[model samples]
Target: MHGLLSAYSPLSKVIRKKGIPYLCSPMPPSTRTPYTGSSRKLVLAFDVGTTYSGISYSILDPGQVPEIKGVTRFPAQEKVGGSSKIPTVIYYDKAGKVRAVGAEALRESLRDTIEDEGWVKAEWFKLHMRPKAITSSNPMDKIPPLPAGKSVVDLFGDFIRYLYSCAKLYITESHANGTQLWSSVERTIDFVLTHPNGWEGGQQQQMRKAAIQAGLVPDTIEGHARIRFVTEGEASLHFCIQSGLTTEALKSGGGVMIVDAGGGTIDLSAYGEGPTKGTFEEIASPQCHLQGSVYVTIRARTFLENYLRESKFVEDVEAMTEYFDKSAKLTFDSNPLFIKFGGARDRDPKLRIRGGQLTLSGTEVAAFFEPSVSCIIRAIKMQCMAAKKPISSLFLVGGFSASEYLFSKLKEELAPLGPNVCRPDSHLNKAVADGAVSFYLDHVVAMRVSRFLYGTKCKVNYDRKRADHVLRFAGVFNDVDGIPCLAGSFDVILPKDVQVSETQEFRKHYIQKAFDRIGLEAATSLIYCYRGALEKPLWWNGSSDFSALCTIKADTSKISRCLKPRLTTWGQTYYEMFFDIVLSFGLTELTAQIAWLEDGVEKRSPAKIVYDVDA
Candidate 1:
C-alpha cells in the first residue's frame, strides 16, 4: 500500500493530515505573528529518500535554473568531490542522544560496533514511518531498535535539524568549487520537501510538524526557512516536462505515466500533456506502494547472511557490508555476476567472480531484485491497461530509477507495450530534489485526482411525514416527532478522483446545536476524509476506508451571536447557532476557514485543525 494518508488518518504518526501554513495561503490570516526583518530569498529542495537523501536549490529569481550540489561535508568526512546522495543513517548513544547523521553516522557506527561501544546505528529507521499498520509479526519488527526514550518522530526531527543546519551552512559558506555561491548574509530559505505522491494529508502534516520541531521553521529562534512540500512524482514531472525529456507522444499532448521508484516507495500517476508546456491533466488518482529499492537490499542481505552462516566473513559485518555497499547492490547482468568480499586466503572458486574475490552469484542477486522489480512491473502494466486514454510514455524517475538493472528490466517488459521509456541524460538521481525547486517556480499539474472522499458528518432529519418502524426505532443523535434522526451520517464535500483546482473551494453552512448555557463560542466544523475509490461515499457507514480527522475549528466568539431559544417547525425548542466551514485547495495542501457572517459582513475567525493522533 502507498504508506501516506495521515491527519487523523489510520496510518503511522510520522505522516498525518497536512495543514497548509495559514501565513502563506491566500486566505486572510485569522491571527498574525509579528514580522521580523526580511532576509534574502533562496529556493531549496530536499529529497529525503529512505535509503539516501539529497539536496538541491535555485535562486528565487525567475530566470535561474535549479542546481543539485554534491553535499559531501559532514563532520569527520573528507570531501571526495562530495556525493549527491547521503546515506540516511543516524547514530545515537545509549541514552538516546544523537551523535552523528548521514554518511558520518554510517561510517562511525560500524567502527563503534567493531570496538563494541554504546553508539547504536538506526539503519533504515525511515521504515518505522510507514503509513500502514503492522503487527509484531511483520518484518518491520526486524528494523534495528532505536535507543531507549526516543520516538521515530524525535529522531526524524533530529535528522532534519542536522540536515537543515548543514544545508544552510553549505548554501551560505561554499564558494568557487562548483557551488552556487550565495551571499554570506542571512537569507530566507524556502524548502520544497518531496515525498511519495500517494501519501495523504496526515503524512504531509507530520512533515510540517517535523520541520517546525527541527527548527527549520519558527521554533523560538528567528529561522529563515519557509517550508512547503511537493510529491516526488510532481517534482520529477516538472523536470521531465521542462527539460524536453518526455517521449514525442507525451510532448504532443498524449498520455504519460510517471513511475517515481525511490528507495522507500514507488509512487505512480498518469497524465496527459496540457496545451501549455510543462502543464498536465491528471488521468487518474495517484498510487503508491511500499515496494522500493530497499527491499532488494534487504533480500540480498538476508541471502548473504544465510549463505555464509557462522563463517568468518559473516562474523565481520563491516567487511560484509562494505562488499554489499560497493559490489552486490550495483551490478545487474543476465550472465552470472559475483560479489567477492573475503581476502586471498579465504578464496572460493566461484566462477562468477574473477581474480579471487569472495562472491555471491548473479542468480542470487536476481532473486533479491525480483520481488520489488516484479511488483513494479505489475503496477506499471496495471496503470497502463487501466488508463482512460492510451499511455504513450513512461518516464521513470527517482534514485532507483537510475539503476541499470531496473531500467533494463522495465524496458524489457514495458517496451513491448509500445510506450517510449526514457530518463534524463544527466542528474538522473537528483531529479526529485531539482524538480521540487522547479515546482516552487510554478505548479505544473493543472488538476489532481482526489485520493479520498472528504466531507462532514451532519444530523439529518427523520421524515415524520412518511415514518416507518425502522425510522421510529433507529438510533439517533436528534429526534423529531419521536422519530430517530441520525447525526453521524456522512456528507460528501469532495468526491474521489474529481478535479480539484488551486482556486477551488468547498463551503457549507451548519448549525450549532444547543449545549450548556447560551453558547459563548462560535461553531466548529469536523471534516471526515474517507479513503476508497468511491465517487459517492455519502452514506458510507463505519464499514471501511473511513477515519475522522481532527476537527477544523474556528473561533466564532468575536461575532457576538446571542443563542436564542427558538421553536423548531417540529414543535421542538432549541438554541441554534449557524456558521460556515470553508476549505480552499492549493496545489499540495488545503487552506481552511471557518467564518460567521453577520449583516453581509464575514468575520474571519481563528481556525485550527486538530489532528486525530490516536488514529
Candidate 2:
C-alpha cells in the first residue's frame, strides 16, 4: 500500500551505480545454429491476435539451418495476394457449432444466411482471456460478450484448429514433395504460441489447454511439452533481428526497445547486446497497455453515438462505426473523411450527411487516435528510464503501427528523446508470427527480467512486539512444536524487475511441522503473485493485489523417511520435514520443482503446477 517510488529509489540508485553489469555481461552464444536433432522436425508459430492472426513455420532438417515461412494462402482469402494474416472472426450457429471462421466469416455471400440463421458473430474474444490486471485498467463495455454456450477456451480452440489447418495446407502445397514433407513430421511437430507481454503462467496454462482441445497436441505431459510460449514484445524483437532492423543499434552498444502496437495491446520491451556476439539480454521489465488500434474504433463509436443521439439515424451508428473502421480509420490523416451510412435519399445537411455519406472532420478523427498515441509515448518514456542502458533505437512494428497518424505522432513526440524510431518496410502484421519462429530458432535472448514478485504464503514465528503482528491476533495459531506462528506470511522467491539468466533457479527453504507421520507423506506449496507497490510485503492480510497464481505439489513419501519424531514442551508428538520450492522465471513460462537433500546428496522431483481453478 505504500508508494512504489520509495521502494524503487534504492534499487534505481544501485542500478545507476553498478551500471547493471549483469545486463551487459558476457553470455554464451545463442546464435542460430544448424539443427542437431536426429531427424526432421517442424516448428510452427501462431500469433492468434485479437483482431487478426497469422502462422509461421520452420522445417528443421538435421545439419541444415531452418527457414521460416508464412502461411500466405488461406481458404476464402486466395484473392488477397499473399496476405500473411486473416481476420480473427467467427460465427456460430444456434446449435453452438462453428458456422464460419476467419476470412470465411467476412465473405459477402454468407451475409444473408448469417442474419437469417441468427448466427452469433464473435470478434475480439481474445481480450476475454487477458489477465484481470489489464482488464481492470481498461473499459470492458467495448468488448463484446462471447457467444452463448461457448467459453473463451472454446473460442481459442476453434481458432487454433483453423490456423492449424491453414498451416498444414500451405506446407503441403507450397513445398516440393509437399505431401511427403508434411506427413514425415506430422506426429512430433513443435508449436510456439505468441501472446501479449502482460500474460503470465495462468494465461499460458489456459492457452495450452486450448491447444490440447484443438488437437494441436495431445492431453499428456509429453504433448504439453511440445507447445512453447513467447510474448509479443520479445517475439517482435526476434522479428526485428531476422528482418535486419536492429543491426546498427546492436552494434552501437545502446539498448533497443520494441513497441509492438497490435490490435488489443501495445507491448513494450527493452533489450541490450550481451558481452558476446549474437546474444541479447532484457534490460527492463516488459510492459503491455490496453490502448491499441481497437480502442480507436471504440472511441470513434462513442463519438458517433453522442453526435447522432438526436438524429433518426441513431440506430445506424453501429453500422457506420464498422464502415469507418474498415474504410477510413487506417488511412485517415489531416484530410476530410467520409463514411457512407445510408442511401442517396438519406441526406441531412446539419449532420454533414449528403448523398448517404457522413463527413468527418480531420480534427474529430485525430481525437479518436490521441489516447492510443499518448499511451505509447508514456510507455516508451517509462521503458527508456527503466532500462539499464541508454535506449538509442526504437523499433515500431505491429498491425497498429501501420497507421500513419499513430506512427507520425510517436515519431514527432519521441524525436526530442534522441532514440531513432524505425518501422520495417516488410509486413508489420507478420512481426509476431515471424518473430516467434525466430525465437524458437535463434534462441538469442540469454536473460529476462521478472515482472512480478512471486512467492508463497507460509506460517512465520509470531512476534508479539510488532504492532502489525498483534493486529492479526485472531489468525495466530500455535504449531505442533508449541510455538506461536502467524499464517499468511509472504516468502518471496523472486523480486520484481531483477535480471535472471535462462538457467537461474530461485529457491526458498521451508519446514513443515505435522502432528502425525501421515501428514508428512506429501506437501503442497501455494504460490501467489503480488502486484502491489510494496517492495517487501510482510503478510497477505487479504490484500486485493495478491492472487493465488498456482500450487506446486510433490510426493514426499520418500523424503518423509528422513524425518524424526520429537516431543514438544507440552508433551505432544510431532514430525518435521524440510524442502525447497524452486522456481525458474527466465523462460516464457514459469516452471517449478521441489528439491530436498537425501543422505548428503541432492534429489529433485518435478512438482505439478495447478493454476487457480477459476482462472
| Model 2 Cα lDDT, one tens digit per residue, 458-482 | 8989999999899998989888898
Q: What are the Cα lDDT values of the candidates?
A: 0.64, 0.85
Error of 1 at 533 (Å): 6.0
Query: Which pairs clash in model 2?
Result: none
Model 1, position 433, has a per-residue lDDT of 76
lDDT of 1 by residue, 1-615 (tens): 011110111111111112111001111111211212243256667788888788877543322322334444555454566766777878777777777788777564477473566677776666666554211232523465666787667767887887777776676566543244454333456677887776555666677777777866675224422677788888887766545554355545568888888877888888875545545767777777777777776676677677667555566444655566555565555456555555556544443223435555566778878877887899888878766668887778777776667777887888789876755545667778767776666466767767667888877665556554245445544442343575566777777667676667777877666533246365666777686666666454775577775578766665535455666666676555677787865467766787766777886654667665434
Can you give the TM-score per candidate against the true fold? 0.82, 0.92
